[model samples]
Target: MAQFLNKLIPTALAIGTGISLIDSSIYNVDGGQRAVIFDRIAGVKEKVVGEGTHFIIPWLQKPFIFDVRSTPKNIKSETGSKDLQTVNISLRVLFKPEIDKLPWIYSKLGMDYDERVLPSVGNEVLKSVVAQYDAGELITQREAVSREIREALTKRSKEFNLLLDDVSITHLSFSQDFTTAIESKQVAQQEAERSKYIVLKNEQEKKAAIIRAEGESEAAKLIIQAMASGPGFIELRRIEASKEIAETLAKSGKVTYMPNTGNVLMNMNASGK
Candidate 1:
């Protein structure tokens, strides 16, 4: 019974070792991952694996897992504009590995593909794009800039086995002096506009005053012509003025009259005389 148990132990250990080896050789690739297989004899193979259980020759062969999902990377760069102004740029990029090119990507660029490709390519593309625009244009037309960057990246990314999902220019800024100059220029423009409004208002008022004076002159001329046309118009106007004076004086609870010779007409003996 002891001899039989000893033989069974050796067999069980051998079977357990084989099971462990098989488990180690098998790679359970998740949904978001892709794999590249390497063999000692044939070197890195062209066949890549998707989301499934894959087997590799242990010790002689290995598997490298690469995340194939959309990933975000933040980067920054500085460059000079066409106007020779210093500009700083911050970027956020969405990217992922191309599924069909996984083997070539792994073999050529390896897992640190982003580190090797994105910085240099992004730098070159950004600098080239920025060189076309001035500092002001960069701020105002940043969407164009971002679009240009993506376009350039789209073309360039193909070289590095990557698909550029998107690129965002999160923030863009300039020097303090430039900002201050812009503010000062805006303030000066506002002051100039205010001055123009004031000048316009003064001119309008002057014109109105001249128009009123001309109107008064024309009205006086018309009145003079009407008086000349009617012989009794002057006398009638004088009589109207005298009547108005008389009415005003009667309302004051007192009465007085003067003749054309300027003698006052009143009852002298009303109180004592």
Candidate 2:
């Protein structure tokens, strides 16, 4: 029984060792991932591996995985504008590794290539592009500025074997003093507009007053001519005035109108109350 047990134990141990070796030798490069092999003796192999189960010699070789998928990164930069004003800027970059250069990327920059290259290159491009424009242009010509940065950054990234899918300016800000100056300028503009409106209104009112005075003078002249011609206009005006007075009394509800007799009877009862 002891002899049988010893033989069985060696066989089981060998089987377990074989299983572990096979497991370690096999690896799956998932979708959106690529890999490069690192040989114990040869350092890093030049050949790149694609997504699938791939084999490497156990204990003598290792696989370094890289995500070939596009990833987003935010970069912030503070630099001086062309006008020497300090500005804070933010950028959003979508980046990935160049699939064909995976081995070189792993050999040189390793897993965090984006982290190392993007910030430095991004800041350099941002400062360069921003320095070319005044602080106002950064806001006014924002698209042009972003395009310039994108072009520069894309070119710079390619030199490092990194691929940038998209680059955009996300945020921009200036010093508090500059912001306050802008607000003050806006307020001044509003005040100037208000002043202009007031001047226009006063001029219109003055013209209206002049027109009214001219109309009153013309009416007085017409009245003089009518009076010189005959007394009919004066009599007509008196009748119109009397009619208006009667209507006012009637609307007060304290007088009874006698239309044919041309008389108004006051409500003595209302007057007593």
Assess each prediction's global lDDT (C-alpha) against the native.
0.87, 0.92
Winner by lDDT = 2
**Across residues 1-273, which tens digit of lDDT does each residue of candidate 1 receive?**
999999999999999999999988898889999888888889888887889887877899999999999999877788889998877887889999998899899888988999989988888888899999998899889889999988997799888889988888887887888888889999999999999999999999999999999999999998899898986878888999988976776565444555773755444345345
Segments of candidate 1 deviating more than 4 angstroms: 1-12, 220-273
Best by TM-score: 2
Taking all chains together, each candidate's TM-score versus the true structure is 0.75, 0.83
RMSD of each: 8.6, 3.2
Model 1: pairs clashing at backbone N, Cα or C within 3 Å: none
| True-vs-predicted CA distance for residue 251, candidate 1, Å | 25
Supply every candidate's count of residue pairs whose N, Cα or C atoms clash at under 3 angstroms: 0, 0
Off by over 4 Å in 2: 41-43, 242-273
- Model 2, span 192-271: residue lDDT tens: 99999999999999999999999999999999999999989999999999889877877875577565765646775676
